[model samples]
Target: MSKFMVLVKQLYKQKVSAKSFILTTLLYLVVLAGIMYWSEIRDLIFSGDADTIAVVNETNFDVSEVLQNTDDYEYEYVTAGEVAEKLKDGDYYAAFTLTDADGKLAAKIESYDPLPLNDQQSFQGMLSQAGQIYAMSQLDLSPEQQQLLLSSEPIITLNSINEAAADGKSADEKMAGVWISYAIGIIIYIFVATYLSIITTDVASEKGSRALEMLLVSVKPEIHFRSKIVGVFLVALTQFIILFGGLLLLLRFSDGGNKWSIVTNLLDSMSIGYFLYVMGFLFLTIFMYLIIGALFGSLVSKVEEAGQVMMPAMMLTLVGFYVMLTGMGNPDTMLIKVFSYIPFTSGMVMPMRLGATDISAIEPIISFGLLLGTVLALYFLSLSFYKRSVLTYSSGGIIEKMKTVFKVTT
Candidate 1:
């Protein structure tokens, strides 16, 4: 037990202190910070008053009110006669001449250095909005009536047969399920991508260095394999806790959290049953992939073969992730239903089933059973060849190496 723990600790320390791990963790942190402060970052890039815009309104109506200074651009109301002077004097970045054409509002910028697409879009949108307000106000209506006229967006009401709408929690559950399913799927995909290399390198590189043979004399194969797996698992979990916990903390306490709070929405939507099922599927998926990675790692007789053997694992991740995305959008379709039973895809699909759809308990039970069975099967299969595969060296592709391992095990 002492030896086993020492091995685990050694592996953990090595991986956690490695340069790759540190860099990836830092990258995740930068991404998390960006997502949390996206609005502020966007403001810094696209916001702030840059240059003064000259606006000459030729219409009798007061179109100058909505043309006031904004964060994107500053507007200075000037007469049409001074447009040339302002352009030549470099007093304005851009000049707009607003005119009522055929009783409709039309504005055009002076032929000069054209603004960027975003600026042009914003300029046209403001003019369009100003026209809307002017057209609406001309009616003989009160302020309340005009406000109602401007608010034309529809609010959809629920009419589902489930108790989803009874406590006003259905919408929360529905939206949160979709959002978290994507989150869970993406989290699984990225961790697998990042740490699968760790798993492969730990086994393959050790095999290449001829260190495993000596190490096995002191520690049993099962203990060594299990320790390495556990060590990498802990490292992955540590990285996740840091990244996810930091994101949640920021999103909960930051100024943006008050308005754009995924943490709050996730809490409101999470039920005991859904939470348990999500965790079950999430663990099963990540665990299954970890073992597969170890299996692939063990297949590589040399460290150089590790990169060549990652294709199979990555292909599975891609297929599962894309299918999960499709399933979340339309959960009850036959495509999703088929993938829901697939062990690789179900971890992503089944959660969407339970959380997004109104499925009964029986479906998930059977789906989870199949997935658990697959994990168990993979565990034994990977364990059977692990000891031999590490020692077996060959001079062919990965398929040939696999065949050699299979023959030796049989």
Candidate 2:
């Protein structure tokens, strides 16, 4: 046990101190932080540069009150003839002419640059409201009635019928949970795939260099294998902490008034219990994949065969991710319910169901139990295979190597 601990510590330090590991951790932190704060960064860079639009009113209708004005755009009123010149000279991002067309309003927008969809929709809404007012006036309705007609109805509030009603979580809370689950699923897929590859490559490299032979002389294969798993997990955990910790700090220090604080909002919506459960499931899932990775890594004789050996685990992870993504749209489906109980997919699907719907306590308990049992079974099975085949060298394809391992175990 002492020897295993020493080996694990050495391997962990070796991995964490590597130049590639340091560079990749920093790069991922930067990339994740950039993605989370892209809107804020864009706003800072383009703060004062709002898109300007030139409006040419050919009709006598006063529809200026219906137009939207905000930081995203500025409207300049001009004559019909000035529209073409302004647009041609690129003085404005776009020019639009509003005229009378068969007793209704029509607008033609011309631009040096393509208008954004949101801007186009806003203009369309303005024109539609103007037409409605004109039509109401033609009906001989009083100003009060016209005003009443133009006013919108009260918004209908929707409440969840699930057990979360007792918890008093709002719609925003549930939506935030859904987003968190999707993000968790995606992160798990990416991290598992990346770390699994790293584990397989590391093991294969050690084997290729005949370092495993010398290491095995002093330590049993089981201790060496388990120590490597723990060491790789520590390396991955350190990277995870660095990336997420930097993001948390960035969110903490960022401008509170910014509208792009999605990460903060998601974190706020998660309760302590939910957060702990997510972390628990996430760790279990990672450890399971790491064990499977180590098992396959032990089978490959050359570093180049690492990818081929890890393909099965990669495929399983991809399937789980795909199911989680597609299942989110319909959580109550029978197929998704079945998938939520599956050990290989439970880590991704169960969290999603818990977030998007109301699940009974028993459901998560059963799913978690199944997942725990599966991990344990895979761990023992992988250890058995590793003990039987770690030292064996075979210059064959993945299938042939797998056959050899099974033959030896048998």
Q: Which candidate number maximizes TM-score?
A: 2
TM-score of each: 0.84, 0.85
Give the clash count for each candidate. Answer: 0, 0
Worst 10 residues of 1 by lDDT: 163-172
Give the alpha carbon lDDT tens digit for every residue of 87-161 in model 2.
878888887788887777788888877778987887677678877876675688998998888896777676656
- In the predicted model 2, the residue pairs found to clash are none
Residue 140 lDDT (model 2): 82
User: Any runs in candidate 2 off by more than 4 Å, and if so which?
Assistant: 36-40, 59-71, 100-105, 112-170, 257-269, 408-410
Worst 10 residues of 2 by lDDT: 163-172
Q: How many backbone overlaps does candidate 2 show? A: 0
Q: What does candidate 1's lDDT look like per residue over 346-395, in tens digits?
A: 88788877777767668889999999999999888788778778677776
lDDT of the candidates, in the order given? 0.80, 0.81
